[model samples]
Target: MALPRVSALRASVRAQLSAQCYHRTFHGSSARTGRNRASVLVAGGAALVAGLIAGASRIQRAEMTGARVPTALDGKDLESRCSCFMAPPVTPLEGLRSPDMKSRMELLIMETQAEVCRALAEVDGGASFIVDRWQREEGGGGISCVLQDGKVFEKAGVNVSVVHGFLSEESIRQMKSRGKSLKTKDGKLPFSAMGVSSVIHPKNPHVPTIHFNYRYFEIEEADGNKQWWFGGGTDLTPTYLNQEDIVHFHQTLKEACDQHSPTFYPKFKKWCDDYFFIKHRGESRGVGGIFFDDLDSPSKEELFKFVQSCAKAVVPCYVPIVEKHKNDSFTPEEKLWQQLRRGRYVEFNLVYDRGTKFGLATPGSRIESILMSLPLTARWEYMYTPPANSKEGEILKVLREPKDWVH
Candidate 1:
């Protein structure tokens, strides 16, 4: 059984309650005294709140009882489903592979993917590409790229996404209570869709892992479809925070955000802080960059333009950063510490991530790729303590309480 999208669930429940209240008040209106109208209105409003609370409680109970909520598909199932989609056309990965490829940005994506892949391959041995695509059981589909074993990065791949689908607002709300919410909407779940990319773990401590994604979504209404937006950003994580590397990473990302809007850097930086938070630890995964989810008000075309801007910035933001550290040597001790930190990363994914749950629920998903974010090694020392005020402890402090980098 899988959980519902929390925001949609909440919105659905709220909408239902609102409808019930409106119906009761209008129906119960008195012809004689205007006072009766007010009375009914008050009662109806109270009933709406009561109904929402009751509905939420019921859903929670059903889920706790493991009342089988049909899952779309898990990771392994998704892989097989996606492979079937690709069997017919043996299009080489080098060309335009996405459906909406007529745009100039799409052309650039082709060149970027090729050039980036070439650069990455040269840095380390060529990455074994794990590419797959599938129609989402929810509404749309997307493609994922995963590269393992590299000279600069231990493992890294940028997952590009394209999707469109519907999730009830009530479902989204329930998902949040369960800590699975991402950048989704409030009110009734809009007829929504998105494209995204996210990278998991990197091998070298010096290489610093990174994650970036950009997507667009829209909401539909009874009168007319309304509201569309673009969202996503890049962030950097290092086992050791080299001041220069941190500066370079943020500066590059700031340039990207600034190019779109001056307000973007601060707004998205805060969003990243909030979005990438490891809720269990009450801290962020690393020094923040720009991260935003549901960005609406902008026209779809405008959103796409912003998406292209962000996407184009990715290679510049990260490849150079990787180039700087790919050759840095590390001792076995440093490698071991890197693995230890990976345990925290795993905890965030398994225990709190929406992606993990979604993948587990989706049929025919690929477990290995879903879990590829996991480090090659990990450690958990029983009741271990680090020396106070040491560099090791400095990193630990930031992990304990996330820092605001741009601020």
Candidate 2:
């Protein structure tokens, strides 16, 4: 009975072991399938994550390289690494490969001021110009050099300025009224101007007082368009008329203008006469030189060359005249006449001179430099008339009527 019971127990144990083996095989296959599905899900997640990272990297690269970086107006780089807050980068016009006009004009004007001051100093012999360098809070700055009580010149000023800032609404409206092509989104307009202007007053009444100015102006629009121009002239005002001196002066300017264009002299000469006319006094300001504005056609290089020619001709045009009459003797009456003529100059500048108006209207302009063109002393007399057919009378006649000195 014990043997029979042991056999039955062994059979039962074998059946149990077989059942356990079959369950293990079947569950193992199901577990393997689940693990494979988990691996596929993980691989898909990793790929999705990689794609997201790649897209983010591309966006960051586009932000860095797609837009133009900003730079300071003075061409200096800003300290910050993030360029989004930087000043607008200088954008040249499409297909324009030349240097920036404002920068070029600034360099040219500064060089011209230095050269002119040096030459005038040599001619002065007794005094040298005192340079006053100043800056504007708005955008730019200038150099003002003045000489007083000199051997050849009583008072002289040579000033060079490079300014950039926003134009007032009134200024924009005025400019638009003058037929300037301007497009402003807001009332304000961005503008840049660079110029060199000089005024020379001689002690000797016989020597003439001369004025010269050359400038470049640019208006930048909201749509990245630019409007640029060149304007300038040189004139002579003598207390005593000297035919040879006046003729030489006009001829020098004519030659300079002719080098650029034959039409420029005649057109600009007439323009000068018309512009400098003292409408109230019904007389011309002085013996006319060449004057022109809105000169932008025929290419910027040509205009630049023309302006350079005019500037270079200045020393030759007036220096010899100064040297010639600087030693001449004059009476107190002649000196008084010179003062009266200066009064007329003051009137013209204060009333009708566009340069003076612009300078005074510009924000942060240096008043001293703007008014430096005025004589150190001026006199206004009531009903003053020169003796008929006298030296003063001859000059008055010329001033009252414009003449073609070169022809």
Best by lDDT: 2
For candidate 2, give the lDDT of residue 291.
88
Q: What overall lDDT, based on C-alpha atoms, would model 2 receive against the true structure?
A: 0.68
Superposed model 2: Cα runs more than 4 Å off: 1-98
Q: What tens-digit string does per-residue lDDT give for candidate 1 at 1-407?
A: 12233334334433432232111112242233421112121121111112212222111111111122222334332222222121111122322234342222233333234334434544555444444443445544444444555444566554433344455544455445655434544444444444445564667776677776555545555446455555567777778867666666666667656655788778887777776778776667777778876555455545555656566555555655566666678888788777767776777768865565655554434465467566666787666566767656777777666665544
lDDT by residue for model 2 (117-168), tens: 6557666774655555566778776766688877778898888777789987
Q: What is the lDDT of residue 65 in candidate 1?
A: 11
**Deviation from native of the Cα of residue 190 in model 1, angstroms:** 8.1
The regions of model 1 sitting more than 4 angstroms off are: 1-116, 135-140, 164-171, 174-192, 219-227, 354-370, 400-407
TM-score of model 2 relative to the true fold? 0.75
lDDT of each: 0.50, 0.68
